[model samples]
Target: MLAKFRQIKTSYFKLLLLACLGFFLVSLTLLFIPLYISFQNSIVKSVSSHSLKTLSQTSYSVEFMQESANTVAEQLFFNSTINQLLYALDYNDIDTIISLNTLNSYVKSTLFIESVYIYSSKTGNVSFSSKTNGSGFEHIDDFYDSDYLKTLKANESSRFIPFPRITSNDKLVYSFLLPSSRSSDLMFSNSIMINISAKWLENTYKSIGNQQDDMILIIDSNGVVVNQNAYAPVLADLKEDPMIVRILNERVNEGYFLSSMDGEKQLVTYTSSPETGWSFVLLTPYSTILGSFANLKTIIFAIYFSIMICGIPICLIVTKRLYVPYSVIQNKLVDLEVRYKSNHMVEKQNKLHALLVFPSPFSESQVLQLKAANQFKVRFDQPYSMLLLQIDRFADFCDQYPIRDRALITYCIQNISEEIIGKVVGAESVQIDRNGVCMLFNQTSELQTRLTPLVKEIQQTVRKDLKLSVSVCVAESGHTIADASQIYQTARESILNKFFKGPGCIVYASDETAKKRAGHSEYQPARQKQLTDLIMVGKFEAAKKLLSEMIENLKDAHYDYFSQIILTITLELNNTIQLLEKANELTLPFQFNTFIAKINNMGSVEELLNLFFRLFDEMDAQLELKKKSKNEKLVQEIIGIIQRDYRDVNLSLESIADLVHLSSSHLRRLFKKETGSSIADYISRTRMEQATHLLLSTSLSIANISEQVGYVNSTYFFTLFKKAHGITPAEFRSKYATT
Candidate 1:
């Protein structure tokens, strides 16, 4: 046994295997700890991402409901018949009943609507569907009593705000007062409130939430906590909540935070709805995300323990074989080294994922932590170049392919780009987003010279293989790793503006925009006036064509110059919008702030022009519709007035026109065009119809019936009445009498 022990110790293969085993065991301490932590992080990150996505989907449901409410309100506001009804002093006639039918139609059209109320500023009497009779707010005090309601009333510019509910179970009613449009009548400025089911919203959230312990909250644009859940604290004001303040103050659209709440650790995921400006927040216990790893620790211990148990016999067998398996051992070590590198590369890819798609404001220390954890080969301090690749018309491509096929296409594109970029730039790349893949290369003396052809090569390869067009934007030289973010921004901006260059267009950040035209020049004042004139004329297509040419010419100019041109165009566009607004005497669709936000986001002039084109088209369509609506409404009003006061001798074209604030001549022409009859003829026809009805229904004398039908001259009334009916009123009565 002693001799055997000496032989085992002396065998080089046994010693070599033991040495490798010892190193591997030590690596378990160093590697497995981080690996376990990394795995834990991966799991937590995945769950949190899932929760955020689920919350976003739930928010979409809410947004869709809000959209329905907004659409209903907009339709009601623009309805001329509704306008006329609201303008009337009382709802005590047949017209009032017709208006009621119209209101009920709106309520029935939307499935989610629990109740709808229209509050008249003029009458101070509430007009709402009777379905809400027992639901409170029968009196306006039920709404005006709320503090936020009072605030909304005070602020003319307030958007749709959530009216406070008595409890969490109370349905959500987003209320708003229509701002005074071109119509000077007080009736047109009525308030609107739409109620949706609280149970539905709650259930939708519950279904989206994977965890039973999760809590959801929805706050509207007014910072009012519109949604009530047991887990959420009702804020006196939503701004009072630190999380809300952080979200608002920081100006981040969405993110996650870990906090100590109610003496336990909680993870909060929050996002803002673009459609409604409402904040959706979700709170879940930290243990739900972190404690899932308890079994992972046991599994890791078992793995290490089993490895230790298996190594003893292997070492004993290797001692007997000695040097025979040395080559095999070397090959195995090589394979293990490759696997270790592969693991590290995966970690690096994850870190890069955060940097690209999410672009968090990571500090230097955090970056360094990522560096150490990922073992990234590229140094931030080194001179670098960036290549941003965007698959052109990605939206259209997505619409053409199913999800699984699109995934394959994306995978193929990424693979091809990576392969070509690797060959060209020596292999450094990160897929930051689905359509956007970034390539990083250390700057060489020939880097700038090589960048153009290299980008084209990859672009051509993707096009050839996938039959897709991709636009490449290059940042040929970056000063340092700290500047990488900025370089990426510049490159991204250029690529986003690809609409101006068209599909498969290439842009370089270092070209004329970055280096040339540093000197600024002021455009002539008349230049703006000319652009404004085109807009005022509603020559949207013409204006856009002119703008396209201007942008193309400015390609060689500085980016600042391009921005100035766009700003000028935007300002002039606003001027034209205001002109049309004043002329039409109505609130235009484009709010100034909203317009500014849209313009600010647009990097390319083509994008701005496209937006302008859409808005202009909408304006044309809306204005034309409004015109037809007003014309039809004026005719209806004329007819309604005639029917209501057919016996009044004073009723005439001038009197009806005065009530509608239109000249008699214009009203007559418009009425004739709309109704295929002149005002005089329509009024006479209406009066004659009444006379015939009275003659048939009653034993009233001819003179009294003529007088009742507004004919002071009985002979003239009889003659005209005979001409209209092709017989005397007495004959018509006898011919069609129900009796």
Candidate 2:
């Protein structure tokens, strides 16, 4: 009857186990559905976040430009000087020139506006443009009055006009027509108009794209491409995509969706700008994003399916094999329990190690009871000392040795220390942490003196016998066994001082105090200079060593004081470097914001030193490169400025200084250093060159050419022309003229 009942019970247990395994597998598989859903949601969220950020950046850029336009228009409406200028432009009287001066000032004050025009229905058109010569209106109007303007004037429904045309040099020019202000009768009355280059918009849009596959489209509300441009060319019409049509019809402000067009899967994002009522569209191939997900899902499903196939048979076989041996295993467990109870000495040693390493706050009576309970217990009658041995270059050691070998090495170190110290005095060895071992021993005198020789023995054994280099530090003697935490803390601090002392040297807490004569040394100016010199010379390791020494030697160094010192050095370094950058018009590759974030997270002096080392190393390399290129870049900038604004009568050293954010004397020195010519001489040369080109190439008159090349005085222009070309302006033009 008993045998039959056992068989039945075993069969029932196997069935029960099978039932639980099936339930768990079913529940796990059910969870995958929600997991997949969550993953899908996460993908959408990530894509939307990126899309929204792109939308925000693009919108901000457009709004920023539009807002700048609105500022000028706002001034045109509100400023009496500007308003009077536009209204009196038709008279061509004294106020007409005053209005032109005012308009020129506006163009100079603004960044992007190249010219300004005022139109009156009663008197036709009057314009002030930097590109024009003289107080000219009709000559400037010759080319600008294209059929597009005529068509735009016929409707006047929109103030923002899009016109992209190729210049004579084959460069595509972006042109926009902006009406400056709104009035009650805008079409019939007076109006101010402005012309600006739209190249900045195209460049800004192209800057956001990354690869050859990406495309940027500026689409209107009617789904037509208003502006055609980007770094990469779009091969397909995005408006015809079903997802884009759905997004437009849904009137979603901003989002991303996957679509297919021309047999290519595409990821499309669209956002409508509040200022223009036009949508900004970004499109890339869907394969770029979702290709990895497909493989990931397949691998994940394969793993789970394998587990389902393998789990049932393993459970069944294990259940069938275990039941027959139940009685014999139960008897062996009882015998093992008896043997475990009999071995009190080993258990006591384990208890002692546990109490030392883990938290065990005990009263004197409780401590006494614990001492009585353990074979390797501490005797409180004598003073105690804690010696901590830390593995030097522990990470290297870990990487070189396998786990089992590392465990054996640790055991060997512990056994050697215990065997040596246990013979001489009452000492217990414990593995306190990875790459660290603690020796808690009772001594009759100062532990530092007594344990100094023992540290040498342990070091020799670890190096000579075990082949591991260790740095050991011994703490001051404690009065009782209960002082383990404090003693261990001091010993750990002694090991921390090893950051200053190079590895393989044993250190002691007594030596640390003796080194600090005062609680902390005052922060020094010479040390700061030394730190800067080290960084400037690119001696990063030496700088790190010096910083660590300074921190470890500070008299009662709190984290706040050390942090302030570190931060002061960091910020001062930044300020000094930034001043250099500004003077040279050079930008370093170091991201200051990222540096600041890492600096803020540094919790210790060592971490701060490490961070500054990296920061300074990168900065030093970039600064070296900048130094080599600084003068050349400055000279090139001056040349570019001269090329762009050679027509400005007011172009001078001081004006160029303000434009390039450098001192006039500094710009002069650098320009001469780089190009062997002064800025003034270079500007003169540039003007003469352009003047000669105009003389040879175009039909512009001599006085017009003089003004166009930055000479307000025709007589002075003729004199310079003689000096530069050995001929007068008319003579030069007559000599070079074809007709």
Q: Which stretches of candidate 2 lie over 4 Å from their true place?
A: 1-346, 354-374, 377-384, 393-409, 419-427, 441-454, 460-468, 478-486, 513-518, 523-611, 620-641, 644-651, 654-663, 673-676, 691-739
Question: All models: lDDT?
Answer: 0.70, 0.67
**Total clashes in model 1, counting residue pairs 3 or more apart in sequence or in different chains:** 2
Q: Model 1 segments beyond 4 Å from truth?
A: 1-57, 81-148, 153-158, 161-191, 195-200, 203-232, 236-310, 319-462, 465-563, 582-585, 591-610, 644-661, 699-722, 725-739
- Encode model 2's per-residue lDDT on 32-52: one tens digit a residue: 767776776576566656766
Residue pairs with backbone overlap in model 2 = 519-555, 519-556, 520-555
Worst 10 residues of 2 by lDDT: 131-140
Lowest lDDT 10-residue stretch of candidate 1: 130-139
Per-residue CA lDDT of model 1 for 1-739, tens digit only, reads: 9999778666765567776667667876677788887887677677678878978888888777777777877887777655544455666566666666777777766766766666666665555653444222234556532443453356445456444454223434444445544335543355665666565667777876468888887776556677767655444467766776766665667888777777988888888888777788888888888778889878988887887778667666655665556677899999999999998777777766655455455555666665576455455556767778787767677778877897677767667766765654554567667678787766666755676777788788888888888888877566544566777777876665565566787877766344443654545567567656777776767766766666566665555566777777777777788778878656667877788777765545567677877887888777777688767766776788889988899999898888889999898889888988998888888887788778877889899999999989999987998888789877777788855
Q: By lDDT, who's the top model here? A: 1
TM-score, predicted candidate 1 vs. hidden true structure: 0.63
TM-score, predicted candidate 2 vs. hidden true structure: 0.42
Among these predictions, the greatest TM-score belongs to 1
